[model samples]
Target: MRNQLPSSLHNGMMNYLSDLEWKQVLDSLQQGLCCCGANKYADWLHTPWIHVDFLRENSHTVLRYMRVDGRALPPVLPSSCCNPFSPTPCLHDPLQQQRSLSVWRDTPQTAIDTVFDKGCLDLILQPMVELLTAIPIVNGCCIALQLISGILLRYIYTSARNSVLVGDPGGKAYGWIFGRGDCRFALGSSLLDIDKKRAAKQKPSGNSGQESKEIGPRRHE
Candidate 1:
């Protein structure tokens, strides 16, 4: 807080804390009406200006306290945002989709072991899903065929986007109108899993020394 004064003030934001101010406020809150939550120890991770030593010391104690006191903390989650709540681009080709995310799920000792687990949801999935809901209305040719046509058109769009239709001229790539060029790296199922696996390997593990040789574009290992 002390070191961050200039940027916060220049940005037209009031500083949220100072040492003496926080100490006083914390004293008051200990006696206040608001309940913090079940994971009171983990909750401090949300606070600013927490000390390293305190976190190192009291953090474990707090988690233990919460556990013993029967307090429950929210579980951390990985989100792709598209689910059965969405059944578009994803459910399009079930077999291909798993090759990206669940690559390892099917690995056998004889098979090249491969599995992908993309962590964060990619930016591409949402817009593609929305495009799915829009097509039936966009063509609007006939009331009877509209619903069925929209679903089929959505399938065509996804196939064009993922596999590159390859027949266009005038210097446009296949599926150029579908915007795969813009969002190609933005993420899709199998590719996202590859990204996730790479990211996980980059984290510093107990074997920090060996970590140097461990990450970057991977291959069958």
Candidate 2:
């Protein structure tokens, strides 16, 4: 089926909805509409025509939760119930069975009143609104990071190209370093040469004086 989104939402707004937001929406939808005191399997099977009408009226929203393929969902059933009066002893669809199992497994002794409260649209909207509010911040950060990355990459490429062309007047040293060795080695070698010169300059003048004194004593002898 061709998935339809609201035209009111812009492409930029959609980017703010992460997988987490979609999951939350799905979870809220699965909660289903409030049974409104309809507890028994038979009660659910014989749900008021008005309630069904209400569901039909809001099918755009309700169908998303009920049916995967936009077809009518299988009837809800009790966990361990049988109707001997009916022709089919166990009229359970695999999908309905799985749903019933999950409901029972989660809350074995769920209260009748709490079993159904309200539709999940209210719950679903809470997260949606929060996500919408954060769009500006999230979008701004993403744009800023992209801009910074582009600028950094351009600067690096320009610097590398310039170093190979102009840094070494002969170009041979830069060409060798850029082609055969990495820029890191080129930069490290320069730092290493500076350190070697500093170490040579730091050699003790006292040591040279000591050598001269020993030579003078030997000459006097």
Candidate 3:
């Protein structure tokens, strides 16, 4: 991500004059980060955005003209590239070769000191590196937690099985932890034994009722 930042920033900056959102983004980065350009202020020299005109001379038609002398002006930096501490006017005439203290200049290091000389990429890269570094550590922690949970569930299943087979009370203790689900799950056979006893008692009562009916009919005859 860091290696590709300069070119990406450059392309984004190339749209600075034509796209309002791009202009705002670059302005925010320049002002908030207190840095200039992709690598240095000199990067703006090759950008086509400098020559693009915002004003259309007439309402119905679009028109473009060179500076007063019919010669193209030199590359100009945006007002956002000005240092907050500089008292001088931030705007710089593109045709002039002299550097202004208020604005970011070409060969920024040798200029009168006011504007930020560092690249915006350098200011932002460290935090991005730290964030990327933390992602794998978080994923590893999640995997470790999942493994531990799997081991714990297997242990519970084993304990519950043992209590059912060996008739140990420990499974009831496990049931307390799971709101009695473990007891119902482990003691399912005891419930089935109860149902069988109830069926047998009902069968004997039905046989007695049939015997009484046969005795009554013989007495009547």
Best by TM-score: 3
Q: Pick the candidate with the highest lDDT.
A: 3
Clashes of each: 6, 0, 0
List candidate 2 segments past 4 Å from native. 1-115, 165-221
Q: Each candidate's lDDT (Cα)?
A: 0.34, 0.40, 0.62
- Candidate 1 lDDT trough over 10 residues, lowest sum: 109-118
Q: Estimated TM-score per prediction?
A: 0.15, 0.28, 0.54
Of candidates 3 and 1, the better by lDDT: 3
Model 3: per-residue Cα lDDT over 1-221, one tens digit each: 86688888988877887789989999999999988788876566555565435533342212222355433224456767878787654443333433442243444343424555667887889788888899999999999999888878866765566456545545431222232235466544343354356457657665788888877756434
Candidate 2 backbone clash number: 0
Model 3: colliding residue pairs: none
Ranking by lDDT: 3, 2, 1
Q: What is the C-alpha RMSD of each candidate to the true structure, in Å?
A: 35.8, 15.7, 15.6
- Worst 10-residue stretch by lDDT in candidate 3? 172-181
Ranking by TM-score: 3, 2, 1
Report the lDDT tens digits of candidate 2 across residue range 141-198: 9999998888777666645564554444333222122321244343344533543565
